[model samples]
Target: MPSRFRAWELCALMLAVGSAFTSNFAGADEKAEGDIPAFVGKDSPVGAWEYGKERGEFWKYRNEKPTATIDASSVGKYADKLTPGQIALFKAKPGYRMEIYPAHRVCGVPDFVAANSEQNKTLAKLDASEEHVVDGVTPGVMFPQPKTGAQAIYNYLLRYRGVGTSVSAQVTAVSPRPGSDEWITAVGPSLNYYPWAVEGHNKVVGGGAILNGISFTYVSPAALAGQGGAGKIYFNQDAEAYYYFTGQRRVRRMPSYLYDAPQLGYENEYLVDETGVFLGPPIDRFNWKLVGKKELYVPYSSFGMYRFNAKFDSVFSKSFVNPEFRRYEPHRVYVVEATLKPDARHVAHKKVFYLDEDTWIPVLAEDYDAQGNLWKVKEAYPIPVWELGGTCDFLAFTQYDMATGRYVSDQTTIGQGKDVRWFAKATEPWMKSDYFTSQALQSRSDR
Candidate 1:
């Protein structure tokens, strides 16, 4: 049986989320940049220095890591702004650093959506509670007010990043074994497409059964030189993972690779749902509670981490990723906590995520083991996807195992010449569902 909040408790929690909007949201007119309700930082409007760089800044960050950094001695100044989980992580992995940067604005989902947002109106109309979204919500956020824990996490789960995105190359890195400096690493390509992603798209495709489809193939190291897999992330279920097995010379389904399963070669350092901080299954495994919307040090406008050209050695480290490659900013985030269901089973007993309020991206998270001990801490490296019309997306993210002193980074672009390519429409040939089928996986096998 799943634990649930009492009716009155649920109402109070919902009110907490609403109060966040009141405390953080500037007036609509002030927050609006030109015609688009430009999303900047929460609790503060965009600074003059942060405006106008919307799309260019994203690319510029990719080309060059930011030069300015917060002084190491002054890191304590941000102690009050960090979650207890983060402070615990700092203690677990000492010598972590922060890079301070301006929170630039991005043209948001307001400009190209058909969702029913604030009178069928938007992120700008967070006050309008008169049913502002379609049952089959597409393009824009569904619950801008986000009354429940499920609603808030759903915003993250469904936030748009265009119709399709393809990263030509993505690097993976895990810390060295205990008492040694050598590291485990792999590289691969990532593909994601949303069948119901097109603007005015979806009247609930398959009754909102499918949120997106993903495919990936890794070609590196002798052990994993030719492994590939495809999975469908449905609206309310576990992902279906399958891949072509080169040695077997056929596509095989991996049903057990659903929740909490460690990715091959990661040594249990990374779990399936740990991608981009929190991604698939028993997505409803816990009873969610909306803690509050609060200001915290979260990864925002992180371009340095995406430099496909950055040297791998510069980023991967014995404890956490190099502090220079990771940036932290003061932004408002919706804090949601999940406790495992009484009848459910998973390695993590409790989890907390601070989702960036502006983009609903989970910027920071903490996972607790079955003993209720904080086991891991995580962060996502998000840069505004200018290509996705300012809708932000994370290009890289990682988690640290506090118990083991190991960290695994996924979806990184460092050393790859190209970054994630965001599409405004499903125009590519491989954007179809068939491209993710087992037959397709076999045809595209590395071997």
Candidate 2:
């Protein structure tokens, strides 16, 4: 057998052992069914709620109506309806308005995703312990009709973002200084492999027990060229990451690349886990609360931004990514609040996520600082990939730092050639589990 296959086999064995232990202690079969709560607005079934030591402060279901729903064409006319924070971030330009339309269920899951979701629902009832395990999930959305915040998040976590995606993109950071349009950009190639989403088992390239693998190598801006990193995220364990340094001609393990670590020297504006709106593990750090469904204006089906001839200056303006190409639609979103645990430590104290009901992808997120004030607003521009039979988000996302006026736009194809594309299916034969290891990082580096 090949060495890579043997490594995967060993990984699978370890996962089996881990699952057994999880089943025993995690109470995989404990059901949280009970009388449905009398929710006010859009009533949905309630799921399990975990309690914190802070008495009377535990997170609970908060089902309520949206503050206001306006048309995207008349967003400025009803500017008073928006919160102060909303107005500041979405300041409308002439001939453009942030219209909030009627809500619709536009998200559609693929058959495989639906099948896996049904299987996950059954497994959750049979062994509640597997509720958060991503390794054993059968290639689909984990919780289709999520009742709790955690379950809703799991839907995003396990959402089918393609089995593998390879893109040559760019990351641009705009300086906060006034009258300074100076921008620092990093051009690179990014490969993301979700082993858990791969169909069947291919010992050479399939992820035996891992959830996802990502590798990125910067190819431009001379100084950052040759700097690369690879990481593997497990279903029930801490993620493992490694960084390749050209000077040393070696790869070094970077265990601290979790939570709020600055990503690729983006001036601390972007965190490692903030990609794709909310991408990291959520069960342990934050106590999530499902705040019910609300109608909101969010970016949806933005096909214009994906044009091969799009320019960076036209796409990215001074204050915000020009809203001209941004398409907004009214959609019922599952509002989830994540509060930093008292025991856990992080920069953001609170985060409110707006997940589209249809796609289960976070469209907008408001990050609060230590003082409980809105500090950063993150937006995900999702477009439907017709070939994939579902919506794919974050083709271009902007992270705006309210305090600093600086923002970072990652995974953007603006300015780069048309080589940047989202593959609905895995096309690369080398997208295997072994290809994301630290050793692979060293070998792939162009030193």
Best by TM-score: 1
Give the poorly placed runs of model 1, Cα more than 4 Å off: 1-77, 105-107, 114-116, 119-134, 205-208, 236-238
Candidate 1 lDDT (Cα, 0 to 1): 0.66
Model 2: lDDT of residue 266: 66
lDDT of 1 by residue, 1-447 (tens): 012225464345334444223211222432543222344432222333232233333353334444345434555666767776677765666677666554444424534342323211232221122112225345556666766776677677767778888877777888887898877778788888876667552343332355778898777756776887897876544567897767787889888886788877777888877777887534657878888877676787676677666778787778778877777666667899988889988899999999886677889999998888888888887766555555567858888888888888888877666666778877889987778777788778844
Reference-based lDDT, each prediction: 0.66, 0.61
TM-score of 1: 0.81
lDDT of 1 at 363: 90
**Residue 315, candidate 1: alpha-carbon lDDT:** 74
